[model samples]
Each structure stands twice: as structure tokens, then as C-alpha cells.
Target: MSRDEIIDITNKFLVEEFEVDTEVVQAEANLKDSLDLDSLDYVDLVVIIESNFGIKLESKDFTDVNTFNDLYDLIGSKLHAIA
Candidate 1:
């Protein structure tokens, strides 16, 4: 999928599944701070990524992911690797 599609899907999931405010979910928005996510929320995020993108993510995969853009790039890299 294209980056725009990835952004749309990720944004949709964050808004619907995580109850994140759509207004706060910008590309550069801080993932945890913007979404008010905790450690348990990370677990849910992992499951969401895997189920939605078919990308299995470990905690380490999130170590460098600070912003929604970071997460989007990470997902793109993982998807590229799979392809």
C-alpha cells in the first residue's frame, strides 16, 4: 500500500480503536502523549498493528517510534521487508 493509505488506516485505527481525538492525530504528533497511551496501551497497539497490517511488532520495534510519522515509517519499512 501507499504511504497515504497507511496514514489513513493508521489514523482510522487510532481514532476508532484507541479513542484518540482526530484533531490531535497529526503526522508529527507524539504517539504516546497525544493518545495518552500507557504500557498496556502499547500491547494493544502491537496487536492492532499485527492484525491490521500483518506486521508482527516487538517492543523494540517501538523504541524509536515517538511520532505518528515515525510509526508510519516503521510500518512502511516492515511492509517493504515483507514484500
Candidate 2:
């Protein structure tokens, strides 16, 4: 998927699942601390990412992903690798 597609999916998921403001869900929005997503929410986020991107992400793939930029890079890399 493209970067805009990823951001769009993430924005929709965040708004629907987490009840967050769509305007706040930017490409640079942090997921862990900035978004205040707990462990359960993180799992759900992972599920959505994998399901939408058709990529299986291991837990360790997010170990060092702290920011939205980190997530963007990770997703792009994983999708590229799988492709």
C-alpha cells in the first residue's frame, strides 16, 4: 500500500476504534504515549495494520517503534519486504 493509504487506514481506525479526533491523527502522531494507547489497543492496532496491509507483524517489530514516523517506516519496510 501507499503512504497515504496507510495514513488513511490508521486515521480511520483511530477514529472509529479509539474515538479520537481524525484531525489529531496525523502521519507524525505518536501511537504509544502520544496517542495514549494501552497494550490492548496496541494489539488491536496491530491486527488492523496486518489485516489491511496483508503483512504479518511480529511483536518485536514494534518493540522500538515509539513514534508515528517509526510506525510509518516499519510498515513501509515490512510491506516492501513482503512484496
lDDT of each structure? 0.92, 0.79
TM for every model, in the order presented, reads 0.96, 0.83
User: Candidate 1: which pairs clash?
Assistant: none
Model 2: CA > 4 A from native: none
Q: What is the C-alpha lDDT profile of model 2 across 1-83, one tens digit per residue? A: 88888767766776787787776666666767556788888899889888878898988999878777788788889999988
In the range 1-83, model 1's lDDT, one tens digit per residue, is 99999999999999998886799999888999999999999999889989999987888999999999999999999999999
Q: Local error of candidate 1 at 56, Å? A: 1.0
Per-prediction backbone clash count: 0, 0
In terms of lDDT, the poorest run of 10 residues in model 1 is 17-26
Error of 1 at 27 (Å): 0.8
Q: What's the lDDT of the predicted structure labeled candidate 2?
A: 0.79
Shift of residue 68 alpha carbon in model 2, Å: 1.5
